[model samples]
Target: MALPAPPKANRRAWPALLTLTDDLLEDIFLRVPTPTDLARACVACATFRRIITDRSFLRRFRAVHPPPLLGFVPCWRPGFLPAQPPYPSAPLGLAVADAADFSYSFVREGKWKNSPWIPCDVRQGRVLLKCCRNHGNLLTSPSDVELVVCDPIFRRFVELPPIPDDLVDNRRFDLGHLLAPTAGGEDEVETSFKVICTAANHTTLVAVVYSSVTGHWCTAASRSWTSLSTAVPLPCPGGSSIFDYSQGYFFWMSIWRSSSLMFDPIRMEFSIVQNVPKHSPKFPVVAVGTEGIPEMFILSDDSFHLLHFDIAKGNEPSINEWQLRGTIPLPRNCMFYTTLGAAEGFLFLHAIPSLKDPPDYCLLDTKTCELKKVCGNHQKRFNRVNAFFGFPRSLVK
Candidate 1:
């Protein structure tokens, strides 16, 4: 009792978390391992909520932590397959899935009540969807449909203004992507985005981009398919619903030709990446390399090959050449079916054991080269699934 009475001054000097400045609090919160944990901390007190909700703090946090892959959203149906136990991010993913609206009910309100919206692409917590009559094929042309960009976690959406008639009159919409913001401060990155839609006619391939900053659509690039490249035949954009983004560029494996189409968003240019591997039946999925270069993953019967494209030195201008990096053997008895999607250093694939057996879905960690089965024999329930990945930073707000 005498000793306790002597230490009253020391007890009174102890620091309180609430007394810390916003700057110091943010410094501590940035170390949160996952967005789900951060979301939980947000409700601890009013000060924690205010500091985490700040736009500046959110941007800094994202920079420190890469977005977590929640789950795959089936393109064929309005449902989500949450990552379950055994998956590293399963717990965080399940929380996000429970909180977000994959049904897209927010877009069905008011005048668009009866309209059907199909998920086109998902990037950075935002879903890109197009309103169309047909929902059977994910690769159908979206030339005449209205586009909507929504944050499903927050249940807010913005209906983009129609692309000008002159820009898309006779062209067929091939592929559309929700681009990550490249410039501006945190507010712009959080609120502003661009949608790049590619369309083609008999003679020309045109790219029209709609910017949220401008609230208008403009032609980004237009070139005759013949002039773009000679090594590959005309591209069939409707052939596959698979595309990948890396290093400020978007890539689509040409189904009709032995090449891939590359789009540079910064320069608004289209070029051909020739001499890519011609793996039939299944196309290689592109993932960003550790050094910022692009790498492709090709799946075969027994193993999957990793290929990297590097510059070939010569008198000629720099051209990307695909080089075999390594190969990872698949589990015995598993046969490759088709590539479902790729994101966040993981590739999703469909596999079947035998002709009579049901298909199994697997996820490949590109870095660790570890393959794990996610779901099995549900092909009848969901025809095709595209993985939708992001950190739910906006969930707090």
Candidate 2:
């Protein structure tokens, strides 16, 4: 006779079959890499989300990858270009601030024909690329968008669609992009990037955003004429470009006065954030730093305390407030970092032990104030280089 059934009053092992607690299953899920994969694991248990938390993992993954990078070589060189303020050329800048602290400045490179490249801090782990002035004829338009998206660390690049010429004023070129996930994703999919630009001409200012998911550009809110009166007009608005994918917005320093006046790259907004410089949001330059987390240094030259702009609320005069934070002032010699994205708990920087030549690549730890060298073949190092360092490799999804 066949053996009696194991269930239905005689024997029961159903509880043991599903004995694994939700927390236990969740812990197992976190180990898997990839958003799509993690998502599937999350579906297995409500406990998985609590443990692995899809968006949380993806975000941390984005921050750690630390995107800003430069992988550009112009088709043709420019005749001549200007530097400083209206910085018509390279935006080669070195940042001493992290997401938390917000004071930044663009370092002017000495060489003009070096094909300078600047690292854009958008989408956290992925870099939005920019190159110095190229041949006018080769360039699509005077205000043409000349940025590309590529892996900062790997040197991989992708040229993006040019910005509409009519929208850009050509008087000033201010660009920023925010990386955010779109609604649709099945199994494996490319993450979406939201590119935002604010180009202000003599009397025209337009805000535009590009959706990587839809593969097309869309108009953001219009420029407010109310603030336009007081809004520092071009000619010398030294706004530093920044892209925050986490908050679904891009930011820039619209005007650089005593304190750097900042603007939002997305939603076409502006604000004043004085949270940096010798006080709160103060950043000291450190070496051997990671990309996402940057060590900041308040320079003696710039204002003792610098203010960052925050325009999160959409419409309103950028509040004038400088929250106090600690400051770091390092010897000019030690304050070397790559002008790129922050990641891996440090700021990627370029430093030259001797000022006679270009600086060597180094990493500065933001949290611990540690410096470590990361450049190899220092002699053949990348020229006009910007960085997007520290992001972990596993979290690209």
User: What lDDT does the true structure give each of the candidates?
Assistant: 0.69, 0.40
RMSD of each: 5.5, 12.4
Report the lDDT of model 2 for residue 65: 36
- In the range 1-397, model 2's lDDT, one tens digit per residue, is 9998776575645554656775556445545554456667667766665666655544444434333222221112111111122211113222211121111112223123444444444333355545545422222222443555554333345555666655554554453333333322344344555666555544445567776556666666455434444434443212333322212332232233233333444345544333334432323322222232112333333222212233334555344454433443334664333333333344444565564565555544555655555433234434233332223232235
Q: Candidate 1: list runs displaced more than 4 Å.
A: 1-25, 39-50, 109-115, 133-142, 171-173, 177-184, 187-189, 231-241, 279-281, 311-321, 354-358, 375-384, 391-397
Best by TM-score: 1
Off by over 4 Å in 2: 1-18, 21-23, 29-143, 146-162, 169-190, 224-255, 259-268, 273-297, 301-324, 329-348, 356-358, 380-386, 389-397
lDDT of 1 by residue, 116-163 (tens): 676777777677777654334444454556777777778888888877
| Per-prediction TM-score | 0.80, 0.52
Compared with the true structure, model 1 gives a TM-score of 0.80
